[model samples]
Target: MGETIGYARVSTSGQKIETQALRLQEHGCSKVFQETYTGGSTTGRKALLGLLEYVREGDSVVVTKLDRLARSAMDLGQIASTLEDKKVDLVVLDQKIDTSSPAGKLMFNLIGAFAEFERDLIRERVQEGVNKAKEKGVQFGRKAKLTKQQLESLRNDFAEGELSKGQLAEKYGLSRSSVYRLVKSEH
Candidate 1:
């Protein structure tokens, strides 16, 4: 039998990993990796990255729940594929999923498919809401730093060559890049 490693994660510092860690220990995990990360993507999760690097062929990775392992079905599929390629087993305690068994693998795939479908539905709904808001004249993105009158005045001042771009930016309480962008927009 290979070594069993554990991973414990909480989305925020306010949450605790003690419960998950204890459960992993009781489940015979020799070492437990822990992290507190709020990002939906796993790119910035240091502990998870480290755990993935440390596990070798025949080793097993255990997590209390699937959500602790990944935020989305695509992410879960990627992680699971990585483990599969490395010849490592994945065990999700709450879901009773063990990739070492055929039935467990099937169950994991089904869950991932459902999760992906749900995410797609949510995305479609959000896009529809955004479209409706736009139709109602709701503006998105950052507000313009300068009004039309201010832009015209700035353009005229630049055309007159009385002051440099830096001077104009200082007078308008804007950056040199902003001044350049505004001046360029006029053309």
Candidate 2:
């Protein structure tokens, strides 16, 4: 028999990992690693990396949910492969996936496929909504930081050559690149 390890993650500082930790503990996790950070990429997941490194043969890595461990199906596959290579088991409580058995592996693959399908459907729906919004004359993304009057003033200032680009940027609380763009644009 080996130790049972648990991992918990919350995307932002505002969210708490206590509930996850408690669940893992109740589920017989001898050790739990918790972190608050975005799972957008695995590059900066220190706690997860630590747990992976610390696990040994016969150990089990547990999570409250499958999504809590990896951002994408590919990521989950890689992590599962690593755990398998290390002779460690993966247990996702919510999904009831325990990679210690043949049936579990089959279920995991099926669930991954379904998750990818769901994501593709969501992306298609979002694109359709965005296209419809564009047809209705809706705008997206952040509004320009500089106002039309400020842009015009910057154009005049640049034409008069009263202030340098840096000075103008400082005066208007804008970046030098923004000032340059405003000055260069046709009035």
Candidate 3:
């Protein structure tokens, strides 16, 4: 057996990492890496990257929760793979996951699969909701900048060639590109 390392993270600076650090100490972690990072992705997590690089064969990496270690199933899988490659074990206290045993490995894989499945279900449901809204004639994106009357008047002004496109855009509080698009759209 090698050294036991711990990693703890909170999403924002306001949150305290002392609780996680205490738990890791109780779990026999000799060194603990702590950071405040958003759990959206593994990017910009220097502590995590350092912990991964620091561990060696026979070493164990411990965390209070699987979520504290990774943002998504894919991220967890990648981190797990890296640890596996380094011949290091992962111990997640809250989930009771210990990758030093066969059963723990199985449990970790199962949990990752379930998390990915849940995300996929959520994405599908959201798409269905969006499609239903579209069917019911719900418009999306930004509303038109100009009203129909305003558009007609602008078109009439452009046809008379009295004002330049820039002048028309200024009058309507629109960009020059918007004016060009509006005038070109008629043809």
The candidate with the higher TM-score, 1 or 2, is 2
TM values, all candidates: 0.80, 0.87, 0.68
Query: Each candidate's root-mean-square deviation in Å?
Result: 2.9, 2.1, 4.1
The lDDT leader among the candidates is 3
Rank all candidate structures by their lDDT, best first, as comma-separated numbers.
3, 1, 2
Residue 172 of model 1: what lDDT? Answer: 81
**Poorly placed runs, candidate 2 (over 4 Å):** 185-187
Off by over 4 Å in 1: 9-28, 35-46, 71-74
lDDT of candidate 3 over 59-84, digit per residue (tens): 99999987788858889899999999
lDDT tens digits by residue: candidate 1, 1-187? 7899999999989999999999999999999999999637889899999999999999999999887888688789899999999999999999999999999999988876776677679889999999999999999999977777888889899899999999999988899999888888734
Q: Which pairs of residues have clashing backbones in candidate 3?
A: none
The segments of candidate 3 whose C-alpha lies over 4 angstroms from its true place after superposition are: 1-51, 68-74, 155-166, 180-187
